[model samples]
Target: MGLRKRAAATVVTLIAAFLLPLAAQAPAQAAATAWTPGISPLHDGEWVMRDIPGGDQADSWLKNCARASGIACVSVGQGDGKQSIFHLYKCGTRSLSNFIDALSVLNNQTGGAEVRFTGPNVGTYRAPANPNVIWKFPNAATYDFNTMSVC
Candidate 1:
């Protein structure tokens, strides 16, 4: 092959080598950042969900929510208590934090608003507003949640 062609080929190869990894990481990076807690609140009511990292943190948050009044809180995953907690105070579709293991959902909206969980394949689960109640879903980690709705 001619030198010019060889040089151009080398440039193309180098560019691809540099860009491919970035392209591959783009989705993963977005996914990582998208899972940030306290990022999106869908509704105009008091709703909270904690993305717990470990069983220990889950236990702690559950106890805390039990004592809190007039606020709905949900907890997901058995994480290290590093993920942010979600807050919703309206009636709309709310984005969810990263799921590690397990889940707890609470609906504390006034006028009997309901909280709904939608998964791509697992369908939807709805919980009505119940004060001082925590809806625990231990198998929530297996489902891929698309959006959470409160109405």
Candidate 2:
């Protein structure tokens, strides 16, 4: 009889022991799984600039502005202090594809400011905040801006 009681007690104890860990862990597990906010870098209204070659005399100044501001000078129409367009690094190394995506995004967000990859460098653009729009050909051919131009 005593042996039977001991066996039953052992089984119950084992079950209780296993369940205790799970029961204790439930609240802790829930807390750990919950997400805590504010882990990412906040860049609201903040931007960086970069200069890509191809723009005429103005290119140098834009490059300087980007360098001075401790950002990047990725391409043209970026560094001019007059426009104050907010630019940023590609979060990492820049690739041609990434630049294309960036250009598309910038052009889309900034109200479709004529996003011209400069004809001068088919790889560059004369992008700005607004008011100025010019597409330059590799031969320095420029498509003058009128009212119907893009950003």
Q: How do the predictions measure up, each by TM-score? A: 0.54, 0.26
Which sections of candidate 2 miss by over 4 Å?
Answer: 39-151
Model 1 lDDT tens row, 1-151: 9999999999999999999999999887755643434326545545455445546666566556545444556666433444334445556687665654456666666787887877787888777887666666546532566678766
**Each model's Cα RMSD:** 8.2, 17.1
Error of 1 at 118 (Å): 0.1
Q: Rate the local accuracy (lDDT) of all candidates.
A: 0.61, 0.34
**Per-residue alpha-carbon lDDT of candidate 2 for residues 103-140, written as tens digits (9 for 90 to 100):** 21132224333333333333344444332222222323
Q: The CA-based lDDT of model 2 is what?
A: 0.34
TM-score of 2: 0.26
On TM-score, the candidate that comes out on top is: 1
Error of 1 at 29 (Å): 17
